[model samples]
Target: MTDAPWSHDLPWPDDLPPFDPFDPAIQADPYRHYAWLRAHAPVVRAGRADARLYLVSRYDDVLAGLKDATAFVSTPPGGAIIPGLLLMLDPPLHGPMRQTISRAFSPRAVNAIEDAVRTLVATHWDRFLASGGGDAAAGFATPLTMGVIATVLGITIDDAARMRDWTNSAVDFIATRIRGVVNPDASVDSYAAMRAFMADAMDRAAADRAAGRGRDTVIDALAALRDEDALTADEADGFACLLFMAGHETTTLLSVNCLDQLARDPAALWWLRAGGSPAAFVDEMLRHRPSVHRVTRYAARATTIAGCAVPAGAPVRFLIASANRDAARFPDPDRFDPDRRGAPHAGFGFGMHICMGSWLARLELRLMLAHIAATTATIAANGRRVPVEGGAFATSGLTRLDLSVTRRSA
Candidate 1:
């Protein structure tokens, strides 16, 4: 791919070190590369010609691009537009759709489920602590997050496990698409299965509501909208699928990240255990080790990001991880300081497209951290820390984190 207006052959700063976003090594720990790019080439071209990508790394540039929805659109021109999938929508369509969806999946809905979520957290953590700890990601965080989102969506526990499996496939499919190497064969079947399941669930929700037995779950809410002609059936089903897919996985990673942090830093653990705010810790963790690191947008028209020119229709990869760590935005950017104040990190993104489920994710993290701090005396890593297979291009966190914890004395 051409390196923008810099030259036809070489990357910006001709002697720049080799950088490939898809490389497993780079993805395993991308901060070093992010730091290098932030310092030297905040905006540069990457990938091959057919699937060229423009990388934007600085905090200000990324924020600007995310806010200027017109300049950097969610979907490329002529790309397949999935109805009800808010992530791919922009402007006029996005605003009304989001507003409508928000009515059903509102903060009140999330808040109402707190007691149940807390109970769910306790059940999982109690078991984990009783076992003296195990794979925190799979044993605790994954199931816990899946359960919470499932409850919110009104999915039965029996189906929650299936949803978890389907979510994994969906996430893999999405990651492959972002890398310009979609594998329909590997993920399409599971994706279809999930859509069908959600459709059935929505149908059930609608039926229950008509019979005056509506449970007021997210499904019920969306179904009511559909019945009232407020949302198309396709939109309702698409939104339900998006909710499960987006809600479960990202929050799981964030939970695991908190566990990983507590295990690694005694001071952080002590602060939490000693009654320091889990809210503060969570905010810093989102910045220091965000579960999601990069987001893609298509350059709608010719534009310049961080002084680098981008051509119309070019694919732009905003290095959210890099932007969060930019010293320009955060003092001593490399260090993980829970007490961090001032500019908010791009962990949950920015502008209109900021994560819709961010409030829910934060609540999950804060509760999980607070519980761990209150019950555990010491938390330590018991084995290797495995990074998520896809790298940081989409979601990034531990796939397997073996933790050992000791309970506080009675």
Candidate 2:
């Protein structure tokens, strides 16, 4: 494999395989390389010469690193590209930021949106069926996820689409820089646009609440926190951007991944149709074909992971994808068996930084899958499979998946 553009900045060990997840070939199928890493070097340093990126592959090691936030920090070496992003902050600081928006995701709030999510799924599925077949990623999955997130954040669907575009641009910008390439202007512009958009959204949400015509929304929650001095305006905007980036995008990927995996396994689909638990199906899918592949942390002090010594302030990467597929953790790890049961997977991450949106995502996937089983007799790939272009190390998902759908006989 070709070296990343930033290799000269911080040379990697020659022994390590030329493994760059963003490389299209590796992105297509990374399991072989992951197997190699797990077997040979569970912990190894890789990335730009200037940036110390240590990758942990084994399941238990990754889980340990994720849970040990004190040693393996969320803040990274320099700081978050976007300040006040909750997922990037370590504890003490992390708790307050998380609590600021936690209420919006409470059990009651999420349950209240169940009908809205189902209606969104059904509406999109109807449109897909009308066309006989369509790209499930864009035509169905993304819209459904974006709609749900938009509803929760009290933003228009159009606004959510715009915010999503900005989020993608910003994420791409940061990913490139992390790889040692420098394309700063566009990504900076994207973050600025998102901040401006979210600020205005908060204003509107606050006005609505004042007028006594308010609905439950993340924006209003953050606005309230800002009023209480629990969060600053910039922090609130950053969190709003996070909601768009993490909340909506990951769920969209999860939906696409579920469709892709189930389409490839007829027996699994049959199980789901024959009264298998949708929750279990989603859990297994998270392990077998997770949307997120890795999460980053910085060594707060000198520490060792998987037996390798890491210096203080070094950047570390936990390979959640590889961890989930670890043979020691899951028997016949590669097999996709919804009926399989045990400990939860690292797909949503581990410990404090574990995805708070996971419950909301699980609810969406469960409902979406159940609805598919009830309405469609079979779904098969009819065209191309376009993997998302970048964020290879971070998320694995499709940008387009054309599928043919057969509706259940009336």
Candidate 3:
């Protein structure tokens, strides 16, 4: 047992386990830990490693709490592992910000991009095929999705590297809180750097709006918000900073997850070739390998969830990964069934903080998957497992996905 990866980091109790997230024991296999929580402390009152707060790991309980906005506030400056990001904002404010920017993600706006997105997807896959195969996560996954986000924001892929750096550093700080450890993401320098960049962008967008230029850019639209007094200079910076956060990482993680699934099940290629909907495929991929393992909530007032008591101002993680895999809610919870038709998985999340970028995410994934399956004849493999990196608490995933490919006939 001592030799087993699971043997070490035996169990997390009143306090969080020591912050050795890179331990092969936990990463090589986390199912045991998940299973333990599922069976034992689904909604246990655990002490924070450095502070005290509640934790929720059960399916139904997590679902309920996520939707309960009155009892749980999202606006606390400290509740979030990451600060200044909109994910921490609760309603009446979080509500309107979502509604205002949601025009970008409206069903109509998403549908209008179908053709353009498809073209980008096909073009990227063609490039991938020419190379004979590469790390899809880097070469294909990131570019395909980030390109669209960049297009929407009126930025260039040449500039994406800088944004990725900022997003990673920001998320790193956020993860430290989830793991209850030193503040790795607490980079005052990053905050100043990010704030300066966004401030510049906002200023340019404002100038563009006054000139009637950059109409198609999100930056332009955001600048327009400033004119309407809908967003202040600081608020615009915060919002753009958050939008940049959403634009960079998640879709990249999701695209890799989708492609890797298709690669593992070679038959999926045929399924796609048969005109199967990429939308459905993306849904399944999210269920199987969600990017955000869990969403956190803090108690605004004392409340009980499924027999667990949480005090006022207590922080809790919704354990979204566990919720998605709950057998009671999902059929054959452990199995990855692309065709499963029933309840939706907790992939985008539920409740007040549901992901505002979800529709765009789905549209982007669908386009990319369709293009790859149709354009690439064969995807090559360098024979490496998908990389999953562990932070003190949060999981960093899909560092790279190595694959080779042959293009469809010109």
Candidate 4:
């Protein structure tokens, strides 16, 4: 099979070390490449013909860029095919927009669902244990994430599964589209179907509210907010769509990543015990192997990253996973020390655009590790593992994690 053109499309200076973020090998293990970039060229120009991306690797530069959002905007330099999404908005617009949907994921709301989330996690773990060994990501993490997001969105678990399929199809389609290839999956149709699904759900929610039979879900809240003229219909739909995408995806990756780390360093399982701090371990895992590898920004105006002149509207890609492991910022950056202490890593992110669901994501991870510690004596690799393809530049996660485990006595 011929490799896709984008796979080797990076245009970098000859003086800099060769690095292809799209390469599968690099995706599987990118620390060496990151170290090279951080040392040789903190900010280097790369990407395809039409789109040029500047990679920022050093911890200082990445964090500074993220903190200075005015200079480095979240919206695409040339705008996106799909607009009005929260992450794709800037400044004044981004603030008001986030306010409208933030209530759904407020600390109060997320904490209230702790019991339900615990139940969901236990149920799936029980099934996985019964089967002896299986893909941890598929069997446990994915379903647990799906269930929590569905509950938050006020939808059935079955509907969450259906939504997840549509999400996968849409993501596949987008990947192929970016590569300028045709996909047979009809992902455009799936994208359209998802939009229509959200639209119809919003209408139903409005009608239910008018009749005083309102449902208390994120969808319902967003729709009501729209009715109050707090947001436009399009904004509400965009927020809901983002919730569907980011909500489950990041959490799934975190759970799988933590599990993978524990399996590799079985000794770390001690940290998950009550005597150890599970929350601290979760933070360290994020620093050691963050799910979000990179975050994109647009130079809203002519700016410089690490002294490199970046023209206005040019794309800037921050190698956040690299920043999390910057030796200058964190001592022994590569080591996975649960008790490692320093400044907080850019795992979730930093500044205005930091992950909105961070609280909930942490809650999920903390509970997951606690449960694993309580129920399992040991976890080890049982078979081959396959990492998720295509999205490694943006997200780090496994599509499959086969693990063997021993259950602790009740």
User: Which one wins on lDDT?
Assistant: 1
Computed on alpha carbons, the lDDT of every model, listed in order, comes to 0.83, 0.80, 0.68, 0.78
lDDT of 2 by residue, 1-410 (tens): 22212223333346544666557666666777788778867776666567557778899999999999899886656543455577777778888778766855656556668888889989998888778878998889988998999988878999988887787778776555443456655467887888899899888888888899766677887887777777888888888887778888788888988888767876767888899999999999899888888888878998887667888888788999999999997999999988897767998999999887788899899999998888887788888998866664687778899898888888
How many clashes does the backbone of model 2 have? 5
TM-score of each: 0.93, 0.91, 0.85, 0.89
Ranking by TM-score: 1, 2, 4, 3
Task: Compute the lDDT of residue 17 as modeled in candidate 2.
Answer: 43
Highest TM-score: which candidate?
Answer: 1
Badly placed stretches (over 4 Å) of model 2 are 1-17, 80-83, 106-108, 172-183
- Candidate 4 lDDT, tens digit per residue, 261-349? 98998789876664678889889988988888998877889877666788887778898999998999898888999888888899988
In model 4, state the lDDT of residue 367.
82
Query: What local lDDT does model 1 show for residue 271?
Result: 88
Question: What TM-score does candidate 4 get on C-alpha atoms?
Answer: 0.89
Clashing residue pairs, backbone N/CA/C < 3 A, model 4: none
Clashing pairs counted in every model:
0, 5, 3, 0
Q: Give a tens-digit lDDT track for model 1, residues 1-410.
A: 33453213434344444677777666767787788778877887777767678888899999989999999998876566676789888898999999998989665676778877898899999899999999998899988998898889999887878877787777666545544554655576676788789889989988887788888589889888888999998898888888888898788888998888888888898988777899999999999999898888999998887767788988898989899999988999988888889898999999899998897888888888888888889889999789876633687888899999899998
